[model samples]
Target: MRRSLQWVMYVAIKSIVVSCLLLFISGLVQAQQQDQSVTTFKELTIKSDWLGYPTPETVKSHPGARTVITNKELTESGARTVEDALRNVPGVRVFDESGTGILPNIGIRGLSPLRSEQALILVDGIPVTLAPYGQTGLSLFPLTMNAIESIDVARGGVAVHYGPNNVGGVINFVTKRIPAKKTMTIRETLSLSPSTERMLADSYIRVGGFVNDKLGLQLQGNFINGDSIRAHSDTQVTNIMADVNWYPANNIDIKGSLQYYKTKNNLPGALTPESYKQDRHQSTRPLDRFTGDTLRGSLIYNQYFDNGAEFSWTNFAHRSNRQFFFGDALNADDTSTLERSSPREFLVYGSEPRLSFYINKGIKQKISIGARYMREEVDYIVDARDLLTNEFSVARDWRFGNHAFAAYISDTFFLFDDKLKITPGVRREQVYLDFRNNQTGSKESNPTKDWLPGVDIGYQITDAIFLFGNFHESLRPVQFTQITFGGAQAAERADNFEVGLRLTPLQNIGVNLAAFRIDFDNKLEFVSQDVGFRNLGKSRHQGIETEFTWQPKQIDGLDLRTGYTYIDTEQRSGQFKGNELPLAAHHQLNFWANYSRADWNWNLNGLYQSKSFSDGANTLIENEEGSIGRIPSFWVWNAQITRNFRWDKRKIKAGLAINNMFNHNYFFRGVDFSRGRMPAPGRTLLFTAQLDF
Candidate 1:
């Protein structure tokens, strides 16, 4: 009763603040309305500033494979984590180690998913990696499920605008939009895992609205506290975010965002084959744990001119700290007397400005030009501790820095009455690296540059069908370790090609098919700790992807969507030549079905992946240590049901979800030092409730 009263009081205070803000902003709106000289153009809308496509209809003209998951689809699928939601996209792979998505291992196409090194992750077009230029690894993902509004995945044709490590592509998360009227939401979720006898809880609160026609503000907070399905695995996560949108003038718009995220979690270290078979849900390495936090902010400004031209400038900065502690042992069961801890800190700052306009010289054309500059710094340290005496000593200390600059230009030509479209673009990149071994007082510096070029072609054969193709060159800057401690001196490069078509056979049915190939050179692979990192020669990755969706008119409130991917990868050089890459499954499939009637909703989902290798050698038999082996094929199913209730101008939603309905067991071979059989989660259930006003 006391907690309830506190909530009531909080809500009342929030209402008072909202009312005052609205009244103050309404007066400004009226004054702005009196000045009719200011012009408002649709092209300068807030959506146009996003890095991803402005609207769903614009996707049809994309030069390469593109996938967008809407908020409705995510909510209806009962997606408790980002890894679960990414399974619906074709040619994408997800591996969960923490079970909470705090540390994501995502792969696009056939690239390695180790820390998602090859992929570029973004939130509202702002980089989220620990050090976007020096480290490319995502040690901490600072995002909450409730704060997301949509997801956009670009598989190819992005190098002209994005850079550094976009070899795999870009993944952008779009946050929830500010509402037109005052709104508030409170949500709670409870999850139970019978196998491990653990329960998890998640709480979320959001308040947002446009105070008036000229300004908008939003605030969101999410917290999670619970244990994973494994013993000794306890975790806590906190996230807070704020956003502001101000249109001081009719043709000028400004947006700002700030976020803080922190997490503390225990790592259920890998288990030996014997231990895994005996009890996969037990955690033997109780000393292993991880802690991380991030503080980020961004600002965007846009200006529109009467000549149908727009100028946009975006600036962002972030600081992050991550630390991991684990036992130092050759195998999971080894009796090691020493423990190791790695602490890393990063600071990043970036600015980008772009201009887009139209030109007509007997043929309609669109032109875009952009420039970017970014700086990143990292402090990496390694320390060792004696478990018996509790004594600590520093082993290695290093600092890395990077200065990067890029400029790009693209032009789209419309011919044959706008039926045929061709776009050609090029980007120039220059990077300067600085590294210092603090322990030895040694320093190294180097400079690298690259030229990336691409072309996209699209033909509208008919109103119902669109055909598109693209060929682009991309580059991955040399990693910090590669330049300072490894034998690699040149940057990695790849040529990407894709051909795809989108069509609608019926009013309610849509289909998309694409074929892609990537030829990569100077691929970097991590050797042992003593050997550091090295270039593993060339490799080839090619694949086919198809997606289908149907919303039949005959059946009210019924929807179906499915996607499939087939990838073929091979090593072209080195000792592993003629062998298939690790974790590159040959086939993957996903299916979803949903139906709604009145206030009731039902959803079902299915996912499957074929067998793959755990090591570059493609070992078929599991070793005694369980560090290398072939992963078996597995399939899982999920179902959910939801009901909505409304009364007295209040709305409420409740839902229940069952995951891994068949209780299927699956495991992945360790990628880092935790070398052994890492078992995945088992059957689980989730109950959720939400209140809106």
Candidate 2:
């Protein structure tokens, strides 16, 4: 362990030295480029506030398929979990395994949803995965819903701007920014499950004000304590965030943010079919637990020139420690117990700098160039003990380090009287990874490089109609565990293609339609026998998605929205060839309606998912434990009502929400091999109140 630690430190130091040199050179270039002459052409407005809610117009203007869930929608829908907020988004699949929403398994366009490893998750444009190259799981999202201002989901053709792990897409959580004026907000919520007699409470507070004309500051705190549907499954989460924004010059701005998060959750292992039938709320593994602590800090600087040019840079660092304990209890009848503790520590730091400018000579063009460098280190330890004899059984320690460097450039050219646009971009990335085991004195190193390219084409049919198409390639390197346990697994790669159209034919109506296809090669799959991951054969996913929104002009305070998605997934080669991908639902639909008048708002939403297989073999044989089988179709409904009022010069809002309004009995996820079912919670209710001062 000592020797491995020393080697990690050495590599870290060398990486830092190289990063400093590169930063210095980039700074010099930026300084010299600042004096360039300005052009009259307008630059393609890069979405700087990926942290802010985008309007419908903004979504329509994007070059690729995208969705934005706003705070208003969150509030009106009474969404307590990220999955709830995203339920209306087409092509998104969320498996609420924990029921409390602490650990969410999410997938996009038929991709693997386990631990959300296939997608990229970010907070304020900074990656937040526990370990991007080592663990690659979004075990903990730093911020809660109350502290989040919006969520931006960009799908298809995102690799040029964001590096690896864009195979599915990018989900960015944007937190509330410092207020320009003095403000304070407080909110509290309580949820109850009548059947299980479980209760959950959430609280949030935010205070912000301007210190001076050039400076502003904000502070936010969030707390959540909840009891899950299963017995003994309790969780607690706490978050603290601080922000400072300064405008030193008329065209220059700087922002800094710090965040802290801590969480602990008790796991309720899956139950057998007979056990579930007897008592779905009973826990099989009551001693299992998960805990994590994370701290992150970031600084951003932006400079805007009079000549339609902009430069921005961000530097960020994060440290997190997490531990998980799992108890082996397949059924209520088991007597023997196996306890395992896996603890990991992650350290990550990175910088991103981008430049944008416009040219109007002949054909108008908007261009952007950016560079990124990041380094991560992880220390992992695992220990096992037998409960019967109280004896130690197994112990292991591993250390890994990863260094990544990338550069990308893109240009959007306008042709045919600014009605047609083409964006071509490419990213060059190189990754260096090293792993070592102290006990075995084993060391392995792998350095990989790739050049990914993408393009987006858009044609404006009219002021309110647009057509767009995009193609991009994505790659995900083999995770540390796969490398260490599976002996150097190959990277996962994919090609994504999408075409979409946005239309606003009527004043109160908007519609979006899209078709997408993803070809995956060397996909990663876990093998139980080897207890490791391997490169599976090729697979294909093709889908069509549509969304429509209508606000009746004749009926005041009434709005309607609906979305539908159809996916066809197939394993092209291997033993499971020609079989539908496991857990990939074939069809999904979402509908929502809202009415507001006289300070009263009423909302209703529904979700439907088609049946899917639970395993790669498309197994139909029902196991006694319900661990492997075909998942039947299911539907869920939720409703909410809110009232706004003022008392003694204070603004107050109150609301009530009922989930699974129809009392639907269904499961959102399944265990492929065991057929073990994780039952979904029944009817649940929640009440919320907010005060503004």
Backbone atom clashes (below 3 Å) for every candidate: 0, 7
The TM-scores, one per candidate, come to: 0.92, 0.91
Tens-digit lDDT track for model 1 on 1-693?
A: 434533543453344344435544554465456543333323236333324443467577777788888887778878878877787899898887776556668899988887888899988887888788777877788887789888888887787888768877888888887676668999998878987779888899998766556776788999999987887678899998877777789889877777889999998878888888888888767678899998777778888888878898987777789998887443445566788999998777778998888898778887888899887778889999997898989988998888899999988899988989898989999999888899888888767798899888888888889898988899888888777764536778999999999999888899999999999998776666787667776899999999999998999999999999999999998789989988899999999999999999999998898999988999999998889999889998888899899868889999999888888889877656678887777888989998999
Compare the candidates by TM-score and give the number of the best one: 1
Candidate 1 residue 37 Cα shift, in angstroms, is 25
The number of the candidate with the highest lDDT is 1
lDDT of 2 by residue, 512-581 (tens): 9999999999887777655676776789999999999999988899989999999999999777899999
Kindly report which residue stretches of model 2 are placed more than 4 angstroms away from their true locations once superposed: 1-53, 330-336, 485-488, 527-533, 670-675
- What are the lDDT scores of the predictions, listed in order? 0.81, 0.80
**Lowest-lDDT window of 10 residues in candidate 1?**
35-44
TM-score of 2: 0.91
lDDT of 1 at 331: 45
Which pairs clash (backbone N, Cα, C closer than 3 Å) in model 2?
A: 626-675, 626-676, 627-674, 627-675, 627-676, 628-674, 628-675
| Model 1 per-residue lDDT at 548 | 95
